[model samples]
Target: MGILTSSKRNRRPSRNSYTVSSRPSSPSGAANGKSFFAHVKTALSWTLGLGLGALLLVGLALGGLHLHRLATTSDFFAIRRIEIRGTTHFNREEVLKAANLQVGVNSLTVNIADVERGLRDNPGVAAVAVKRRLPDAFEIRIRERIPAFWMLKDGVLHYADNRGRTIAPVSVGNFLSLP
Candidate 1:
């Protein structure tokens, strides 16, 4: 009974004892290769989607331009009527002649800035605004110059504004009642 019992030690495998295989192990290596291919496929799909989206946007812009051209040139948007507002000194026909706007003309094609400049060239007009009343109308708003006083200049009576801008001359008998 005094004899020492012989002991057997259970040994675990060391970290360096694991062998590196040349070929991929069954499931893990296969999954890794599949994931790489899936990533490549997703990247390619995204690239193609972006490219197509850009092309679609360009096509839409071109289509919109064409549609705008058609709409502007068509008779549907032509000027069927010209309406003048705030006109007291000048007649509607005179304003229209200055603006060069005629019925059956394309309203969208009318240059409003040019019309305004032309109208302002007249001495009777103090301010002018040109606008397109969509679909078939052209609207012209004008502000005429007001006479501030009547003066006898060069043996002739003339109506002048505050800025000393001489308006039309009048007869003595016509305005003799005024002070």
Candidate 2:
């Protein structure tokens, strides 16, 4: 009983307390939660700016697509003439037939490498160079293989170049007296 009384006399009891503060707000009266409204206004402005930027990007993309369509399909881009250079073994008709090209085709639709590949498929063609004359023409230069020997195959004679590479089969139109 004496020990209990001594501990109770030395210890102090705890109590609850409240505090008050004076925080400053904007110079313009912000009593009605104006700070919240300002935050909302800034967020809306950012969203609106982002939306406008996206719309501008979409408009530019659409404009580019429209211009590409117009350029590729317009008659103004149609080929008017084709110039074939360096043709020795094949004629103009044969070269065009090999390249599968014709006038009035869209210039933009023509693939230069494809045309060269088509011409190179022929055994007589050793090398090829193709050029596009903008807005309506194409120029192709073909280096033909000159026959270094005459090869006889199954009673028919074919043209052969220096490396024993066979050229086209000899026909009346492309006949050459080669040893």
Candidate 3:
């Protein structure tokens, strides 16, 4: 009897003592803890990846701007010749003056839209097209407004187009033949 009692005392405590309460231990508690950590890790990974991608895009944009500046400032793209086309009422010098392009200016640096707008502001120009003929030239095409009739306004003869816009003052030699 004494030996049996000693053997019982020597035996290790049951696994139930690992928990503070008498409630049965569940594997689900450990799994829940692991899953929470996994979720945190996944969120952090996505955040880091998105941040890196944004940085890469900004770097590419800056690089493109730098390259564009270099190409526009290079001498090889200087404007040497300006070809004026589709002009009948306006001379080449008049079109060139409206364009305001300077010889030896960088072709790529010219603002075509501004040039077109300046030409369009002229009373005689109906439309204008400006293009860079790569390497050293610009081609300008002008469409002139035609005078449709002559109007006598304020005791002065004025030439007018189809839109009723006054083009210029008519002289005896200019619009006298047009009844």
Candidate 4:
């Protein structure tokens, strides 16, 4: 597009007055009114669209935060049952105490890494996985260290692994004797 401007000069007894005018920058656009209005309309529509998109993005982020807060702190997500798996050495109470889990606690507030770390503190836990089943349950999977031999130290029976490390203490009610 190009601009075409004209000026009109008038002479007076003591002063000169000049007037300036403007037209479309393009020669073809000067005669085409519909195309010019259409371009303006399209630009307006595009600006409105971008503004709406930004509003929706902000709304979604805020809604997600509110929902997350609800999910984490609500009593509806309290723990009701805990399912323990793949444990032949450690019992349910032992595992729960090690993982620091108790019934009626908020399930969503439980941290997987912290639970895994607590479980790993047990000498018998070779590998452990903790998962939350939303709204009321948890799944605990464990891989226990195999005992290579039994050791009696300080009048206590302890199970030792192949690396000569103490795996766990032998319980009276439940005992696995190893030569």
The TM-score leader among the candidates is 2
**Candidate 2 — which residues are off by over 4 angstroms?**
1-34, 153-156
List candidate 1 segments past 4 Å from native: 1-36, 147-159, 168-179
Question: Worst 10-residue stretch by lDDT in candidate 2?
Answer: 14-23
lDDT of 3 at 30: 42
Tell me which residue pairs clash in candidate 4. Answer: 2-25
What ordering of candidates by lDDT runs from best to worst? 2, 4, 3, 1
Estimated TM-score for each candidate: 0.63, 0.76, 0.60, 0.61
Between which residue pairs do clashes occur in model 2? none
Give candidate 3 regions above 4 Å deviation. 1-48, 147-151, 161-165, 170-179
Ranking by TM-score: 2, 1, 4, 3
Clashes counted in candidate 2 amount to: 0
Candidate 3 achieves a global lDDT of 0.82
lDDT tens readout by residue for model 4, 23-134: 3556446344456777888889999999999999999999999999999888999999999999987789999999999999998888989999999998888999888898
Give the per-residue lDDT of model 1 (tens digit) for 47-91: 999999999999999999999899889999888888899976677
What lDDT does each candidate get? Answer: 0.80, 0.87, 0.82, 0.86
Pick by lDDT: which candidate is best? 2
How well does candidate 3 score on lDDT at residue 39?
Answer: 76
Once model 1 is optimally superposed onto the true structure by TM-score, how far is the C-alpha of residue 117 displaced, in angstroms?
Answer: 2.6
TM-score between candidate 3 and the true structure: 0.60
**Per-prediction CA RMSD (Å):** 9.9, 10.6, 11.7, 11.5
